[model samples]
Target: MQAYDAQTLVLCALADGPLHGYAVNTAIERLVGTRLGPGSLYGALSRLEAKQLIEPADDAGAQPRQRPVRLTPTGRQVLERELRSMAKVAAAGLASLKVNPA
Candidate 1:
């Protein structure tokens, strides 16, 4: 749960369902204001797959298509753990802000 790039998180979020890279890129932009290019997108995906955070899914798109992706149970566990850690961090930050008023 160390700080991960926003697109990485966005990718994990979309693993709730299979999605193409374009859909993932748009979601990343919408969710985190990051403009993800092809190299960056696939690089992240490759690393994530290596880490077992996501896996390839079948693509049914009609074009020069790309593989869709979805989360494994391991991925879901990792996401949940990261989210809980983020919540704890946010809570601590909020507490500090309240105490210091800065």
Candidate 2:
């Protein structure tokens, strides 16, 4: 099971598409509305790495020592499953709201 929060999980999932840490952080800020702290960021990175969901890639073309992140097949599968499940829950909620609008 993922130990990270929804934000961390989503960030990791997005990095699967390939992005350096700075870019990842920036993208996350854009998606989430606030910058992530170092402790939480690294902690989530460690957990994702341990789970084999995301891996570090060479940053030859990156800005200086920036390392890129890539998602593993397992990570992709996990994210897909999570997305589907979340969608289902959202659908149910929407259906309910339709019946009882406020």
Candidate 3:
């Protein structure tokens, strides 16, 4: 699995459903406790779009830049796989530290 930062966050934000840029940021903030600036959000969006991980949705009232986006099937699969990998790493780290299971 590839190491991801904002990209993973972005993907995780969209995992629940479709969201426009602003909404995506909101979701990300709620999830990660930080807001992505416009530049960072859009940059991650562009890369995700280019990778075919996400696509615009049929949001008629939205402007081009505000159009909602949903993860593609491939995107969901990739995100799920990545999450599983992350879970494994987290488990290992916790175990190594002798952290009690929640």
Which has the greatest lDDT?
A: 3
Q: Which stretches of candidate 3 lie over 4 Å from their true place?
A: 1-4
1 or 2, greater by TM-score: 1
**Candidate 3 lDDT by residue in tens digits, 1-102:** 333488888899999999998998899888877888888889999999999999988886788568999999999998999999989998999999999656
> What is the descending lDDT order?
3, 1, 2
Native-to-model Cα distance after best TM-score fit, residue 26 in candidate 2, in Å: 1.1
| Candidate 1, pairs of clashing residues | none
Ranked by TM-score from best down, the candidates are 3, 1, 2
Clashes of each: 0, 1, 0
lDDT by residue (2-98, candidate 1, tens digit) is 3457445655557558776678777776766665667778787777778887777775453422667878788887777887887788789989788
Using alpha carbons, what is the TM-score of model 3? 0.89
Q: Could you estimate the TM-score for every candidate?
A: 0.76, 0.73, 0.89
Residue-pair clash count for candidate 3: 0
What pairs collide in candidate 2? 16-71
Q: Which pairs of residues collide in candidate 3?
A: none
Off by over 4 Å in 1: 1-7, 60-65, 99-102
* Model 2: residues with Cα > 4 Å off, grouped in runs: 1-16, 60-65, 99-102
lDDT of 2 by residue, 4-95 (tens): 36434544436447776566777776765665677766666667778898777766566532767777888877877777887788788988
